[model samples]
Target: MQYNANSPAEYIRQVPAERKPAMEKLRERIKKNLPSGFEETMSYGMIGYVVPHSIFPSGYHCDPKLPLPFMSIASQKNFIAVYHMGIYTMPALMDWFVNEYRAHYKAKLDMGKSCMRFKKPGDIPYDLIGDLASKISVQEWIDFYQNSIKR
Candidate 1:
């Protein structure tokens, strides 16, 4: 009952049947909005879409290979999580994101430093979440790459 962990099929296999559809839907949503150059892969035993160093490479900061946070999607035992470093690092967006969740979602959305966990798809704040995903325009990501290349 285990999967390869290196393949999306393997990752999808472990998700319970009931959660599969929701997980797939989330995957599609994430893919749709992700800025180009972000790689879709499995990480930490869950379906994680990462902006590999290629997009925001190391040395963007002090180290040439410093680890950067990512926006991730994960399926857990009781809920699915939408994770974005932006939630914490981008102060301008966090409060508005939280308020939108409160206004649009009927269920309580639990938050962490970088993630939002929803018990069901219905609980997901889709519009706001999509806006958050799209808020950072592709140009911003490209700019990060260009800047990183210089470092």
Candidate 2:
């Protein structure tokens, strides 16, 4: 996946007929939960919901023109992934999420430092996903930015 500016768009455009339903279903789920001012589109070859750069001028890497994305959900060759943003910053939120996931799912969640991946959308635990997405109004993300500066 050589993802560039056109990658996400191309991927969605290239989506096969069989995958459309699941893809659209997941997109709708994310859309309903997305905070205001957050823009939805394909970026870096994935379906990304981004917090526009202007909203947070100093985005992820001090790149004002580049928005800090809240998450990017993708149907990959091997799996599907839901990228959670900067969970490490909110220790309490992270703990609650993991604890709750374990309590309900009875399994250890697998993630690469911050991203969670599953082979299919059906494998996605809706309760846990919705629980995390439901937290904090958009203001909270900005507040996290205001209170915690980039190190």
TM-scores for all candidates: the values are 0.76, 0.77
For each candidate, what is the lDDT?
0.68, 0.67
Score residue 88 of candidate 2 by CA lDDT: 52
Model 2 steric clash pairs: 8-45
**Segments in model 2 whose C-alpha atoms lie over 4 Å from true places:** 2-10, 16-19, 106-108
Clash total of candidate 2: 1
Q: Name the lDDT value of residue 3 in candidate 2.
A: 39
Candidate 1 residue 48 C-alpha distance from true site, Å: 2.1
Query: How does residue 10 of candidate 1 score in lDDT?
Result: 71
Error of 2 at 84 (Å): 1.0
Steric collisions counted per model: 2, 1
By TM-score, the best candidate is 2
Give the TM-score (vs. native) of candidate 1. 0.76
